[model samples]
Structures are given as C-alpha cells and as structure tokens.
Target: MTNSNVFQNLSQESMSLDQVFHNIVRYMKQDVIGNYRLIFGTDSQVHTDHTLFITGIVIHRERKGAWACIRKVKVPRKMTNLHERISYETTLTEEVVSLFSEEMKQQLIDIVLPHIYKGASFTIEGHIDIGSGSRNKTRVFVNEMVSRMESLGLEPKIKPDAVVASSYANRYTK
Candidate 1:
C-alpha cells in the first residue's frame, strides 16, 4: 500500500487511542492554568519489566511558528510476569500524571508562548511513542500542552488525519 493509505488505515484503527489522548491533553491544560503547578516522574518499575522506552513530544504551533518539546521516559524491561509488568506500567503512568502541571509551565513560558506574538493560526501537536506499550501516555502529554496553550489564550488545532497533506509535506515538497 502507498504510505498515505497505510497512514489512513492506521489512523482509522486508532480512534480510541486518539480519544484517550485528547482527554489527557485537556486535563493537563486545565491543571496548569487553573492550578499553576508542575509535574514529572519516571516509571522505572514498569520500564524494568516492560523493556521499553516511552517518549512523549509536545509541539505547539502558531501561524508559521512552532515550538517542540520532548520528554523521554524509560519504562523498565519486564523482569517478571505479566502482573509485574502491568504494575510497573501503572507506576510509570502515575509518574507521568504527576509531571503534567510543571512541565506544562516550563514548556509554555520557555518554548510555546514566546512564539505566540509571531503568528496567527496556531496548532499544537503531541505524540507518544510507547514502543511496546500503548498510546495512553502520549495523549496525556499532548493534552497537557494543548491546555497550556489555551490557558495562554491560544487555541490548538489537532488534526489526526492530515498526515498525507500536512504542512510538513508542503514545506519539504516546495
């Protein structure tokens, strides 16, 4: 199949993942602007059991300007049974939850907000690569970033189906 078609198929099968992610992003934004806090942690126990690295990326865009930030969390390799692996993953998830507020603040003041005055149409993108796990963490990270942007009086544009005809494509193709 063509790359575009492959991406389309993948997107369709991942709708539930997308919804969970959106919820996390929304929560992060609310926690930041409303509570003014920061959150962070490592799911070392889970990583030790799962043998995977979970990385999160938050991309905030405004007009022609964008700021991207990445948070790499190592989920320990699986050292025992499924139960142990699950427990570890759960711990890591909790750690991620804790980091939402603080990370959002740093990303906004340090990266995203500065670009706001430079453009109009703003879009904030977030991705999580849970190598061997799921998309839960990635969605959480993105939602947090989006919320922060909103709190700053910016609206976020999250389009999960525009990969083939994306701005990145237009830029490179031109």
Candidate 2:
C-alpha cells in the first residue's frame, strides 16, 4: 500500500498492492468450491545496502493446500533489535490485510465472515515472524504482537506456525 514498487507477480510483473488484491479476489471468486482462510504475514532480511521486507497474503483452502501473493519492499535503514524488526513486520502485514479487507468488504461479509460467524472452521490470521526458541530473541515480542493482532480482529500466528511469513515470504526477501 505504500507507493513503493513493493509487490510483483511470480513472473516478475510489477503491480500496485490494489491491483494485487483485485487479482486475488478475482481468483477467489472463480475458485469458490471449498472453505478457505486468508492469512497475512511479513518477513525482512537485512543486506549490505538495504533491508528487504516481504509481505504475503495466503489463501488456504481446507484439504487443498494454499497459494499466496507476495510484495517486497526495500529500505535503506537498518534495524538492530528483534522486537523492533518483528514489530515492523507486524505493521506491514496489518497494512496489507487492511487493504484486502477494504477491497473485499462486501464479499467477506456476505461469504467468508458469515461462515466464520456460523462456527465454520475457517479463520483470518496474521502471522508474525517471532519464534519460540530460547535462542531466538524474537520470542520476547510474541505476546505484544499477538495482542496487537487480536486487537486488529485477527487470529495471530508465530514462528513454526507462521510459515507464510517466516518461510514463504522470506524466500523473496533475500
């Protein structure tokens, strides 16, 4: 959503975040045979000249695996703390989800959220890059990040459980 060339198609076709959302929704509407979950996440890698941040939105269909849309953004600044980096990652994921929600409001209300409200086993979650290993200092930010996601009305996911952010998106950040 930030007017930076932050997102691209798998074929390396560049497009704005709004275009990406519309594309995803078009796919979703065409492939509406099963239950699905919309997951958002972000990951970052620091290089010599800049830090790369990648955000992903994953559409998971029960018993059918998933597919994702990713966006990458680079910043010249560097981050030193686990909490700060993780927090920024959370913000990126949140922004992407916000735009998705805005674009898909009617569809979500009439289709997805209703299933969730009726006790369907579907969810919309935000994944954070923090892990639980003692060797991982990012664990310190897990509680705060989880609370933040909850406040945003999303279920939260952390490392191990957050492959969409920490793994899938991480591939492109580098």
Candidate 3:
C-alpha cells in the first residue's frame, strides 16, 4: 500500500470524544462499582484588584463503557467580605496579601478533586496579573492544584511565565 493509503486507513480508527469518554468509563467502572456519583466545583475570589479563579473538569467512566459523563465546574471571583477591614489600609503588606491568596487558592482546589478520575493524570494552565500594587494570587491556586494532583498520582504541567512574556515581547518587536 502507498503511504497515503496507509495514512488514510489509520485515520479511520481515530476515537471521537464520545468514544474516549466511553473508554474512560469502561476503564474506571470497577472502582466505583454499585454506588457512583460525579461532582465538579469551580471557585474564585477577588481581593482588591486581584482575582483568582479555578475550574475543575471531572469525568466519571463506568465499567460497562456505556455510562460515562463529564462535568465542568467554574468558580468566579467576587468581592470579599473582608474588604471592610482592608478599606482603611492604604497599602497591603506582602505577608497579608500572601495569606489572602493562599486561602483563596485552597478553597478552589478543595472543590476540584472530587470530580476527577480517581487515578488519571491531568494538568492546569492559565495566566494571572495583578496591578502594580497588588500581589498575583493565581499562581498560588495553580501551585496548590499541582500539589493536589501529585498526591493523586497525577502529574501537573504548569506553563512557564516566560511564555506569556514572549508573546508580548513579539508583539512589540514587529
């Protein structure tokens, strides 16, 4: 057979999203057994000019292969009640900002794990920017997610900060 013909034939076996979902469920069914439930949660928090959002996608694959479903949970940032206390403080100390960021990230990660494949590997990537005076908290959430995934035998890949910088660097060069 010609190379083109070989490529054509191999392409026919490519699995669709539905097929992959089925396979995942079929692969996971035994662990869940008689009682199985899938849940997903996304949480976010906003402190001053900084916003932290985390999204978790969960897929529950069934043993029989036919009963698998995926759920996406998103958490959005909103103003915090503590704003009242910080209202009078003109500038936030590095320690105070760090604590706030860590707390928010933890809250988001705590909600993501229940919906993931028990032993499947996954990664989370995104960007975060805090205005001149604010500390970026998005990194805290990403790091926490990676740590949690590691505990579950899953490896997480976080994109490097240089990638974002390069994108903007190129924008001005040309």
The alpha-carbon RMSD values of the candidates against the true structure, listed in the order shown, are 15.6, 3.1, 17.6
CA RMSD (A), model 1: 15.6
> How good is model 1 by TM-score?
0.26
Q: lDDT of model 2 at residue 34?
A: 49
lDDT of prediction 3:
0.29
In candidate 3, position 60 carries an lDDT of 30
Give the per-residue lDDT of model 1 (tens digit) for 1-174: 011111112123332323433433554444232211121111222333345422222232212222212123333344455444334433443433434455643444543244445532223322111122254434434455445434533333333422211233222212
How far does residue 167 in candidate 1 sit from its true spot (Å)?
17
Clash count for each candidate, listed in order shown: 22, 0, 5
Q: What is the TM-score of each candidate against the true structure?
A: 0.26, 0.83, 0.23
Residue-by-residue lDDT tens digits, candidate 2, 72-173: 777776666667778888888878877765446556445545455454444688988888789997877888999989988898889799988888888888
User: Model 1, 80: alpha-carbon shift in Å?
Assistant: 8.8
The list of candidate 1 runs beyond 4 A from truth reads 1-50, 62-76, 79-94, 100-174
Across 1-174, the per-residue lDDT of candidate 3 in tens digits comes to: 001111001123434334443443454443433223222222233545543332222333323222222211111333364332122110111112222234433433444345455543223222111112235334434444445434433333333432211232112212
Which regions of candidate 3 fall more than 4 Å away from where they truly are? 1-20, 23-70, 74-136, 161-174
Ranking by lDDT: 2, 1, 3
Compared with the true structure, all predictions reach lDDT values of: 0.32, 0.75, 0.29
